[model samples]
Target: MTTQKKVSRQVTLELEAGNAAMVDIGKMLGPTGVNTRQLKLDYDEATAPQRGEIVPVVVTVFEDRSYALRYKTPPTAHLIRKAVGLEKGAGRPGSQTVAKLSREQLREIAERKLPDLNTDDVEAAMRQIAGTARSMGVLVAD
Candidate 1:
């Protein structure tokens, strides 16, 4: 007997942890599907960080109405805020500095974000993070 292979489709969504909706998910599932309830549960379970941060998710829906989920890291701007303990970035980024970070602190952030950063070494990752921080009105010191 020949084996049948189920085809899977991928949909990327920026879902707030534990607060997904049927309408948003239904749009991805299309008119022919009815497994949105299960998909919502899966999204909530996968993003249990409790901070309600928006996360990029890749949902692979199979032919049988079953789905797999992949959660990506939070954005660099969010990570920088957490690292600097700020509620928001500076409004006037060029004229105002909201926070500061040491080289060691930047390095730690770089290491934590190494998996998500598109860089070969920690130094390059740190540079990228530094650029993000600067854009957010955070000064990085040596």
Candidate 2:
């Protein structure tokens, strides 16, 4: 019997500084539409917390020798609100604000959107779907 396995692996690029060296790296990634300026901006944001820690960048390298970098900020407030069904802001957020989804909101969305779920209960389904959304980095609100 032949065993099938997952084919791809995740890779990361760890840089010591915010964007001090991205110019050199940009020359390498330019052809692939990996904007050097954007990369630097993302690098700065990721490193904003530590201000001194090494920023680890996870990138997806396709077989074509071109790669896509995964460096970005969290979803904006408007995004989270839309995901949760609020038209505007909820409670105050910290410097890096994170929007929230109440249990009610979670249940409502899951009940409406998910077609594959066999269960009929909205609350249970919502909780399950919320977990899925969180893992996928989807901002329904945004």
Candidate 3:
């Protein structure tokens, strides 16, 4: 006999700090019964440094149609970007920055918003923020 399957849906799963400790990975999977173990591991690794934040994960379907998952940090450095309320692909803090950006920039960042950034390092935060800008089409002068 032969077996094959395809992914049916993509979800922006919400995960918290202690998501791993929970045993029922299946319940969060919904009625589809998609396996959450691998997905949970991916998410945990990607967002381990900032465990509390809700990281963006890409869930793909395998040929058997079960499901495969991968995690990415907002697909475009959004965690820190959305924190300062700046534009996507926008500017940095030191090289002439502003507390409030233009409306379009705000909208752009908002559209590509990351779940929540619970970090303390400003530099690391900025790097993450700048990535959002680049993804949003903002070109850094440097």
> Which model, 1 or 3, shows the larger TM-score?
1
Clashing pairs in 3: 5-63, 5-64, 5-65, 88-133, 89-133, 89-134, 89-138, 90-133
Lowest summed lDDT across 10 adjacent residues in model 2 is found at 71-80
TM-score of every prediction relative to native: 0.75, 0.32, 0.39
Candidate 3 minimal-lDDT segment of 10 residues: 93-102
| Clash pairs, model 1 backbone | none
Query: Top model by TM-score, which number?
Result: 1
lDDT of 3 by residue, 2-57 (tens): 75566666655545533553344456464566556665676577667866555555
Candidate ranking under TM-score, highest first, comes to 1, 3, 2
**Residue 62 in candidate 2, Cα distance off native in Å:** 8.5
Model 2 residue runs over 4 Å out of place are 1-11, 17-20, 61-142
**Stretches of model 1 off by over 4 angstroms after superposition:** 1-9, 18-34, 49-52
lDDT of 1 by residue, 1-142 (tens): 9976475677888777778867888887765374888878878886776446767788777787666778887778887898789999999997899999889889987887788778769999999999999999999998
TM-score of 3: 0.39
Evaluated with lDDT, which candidate comes out highest?
1
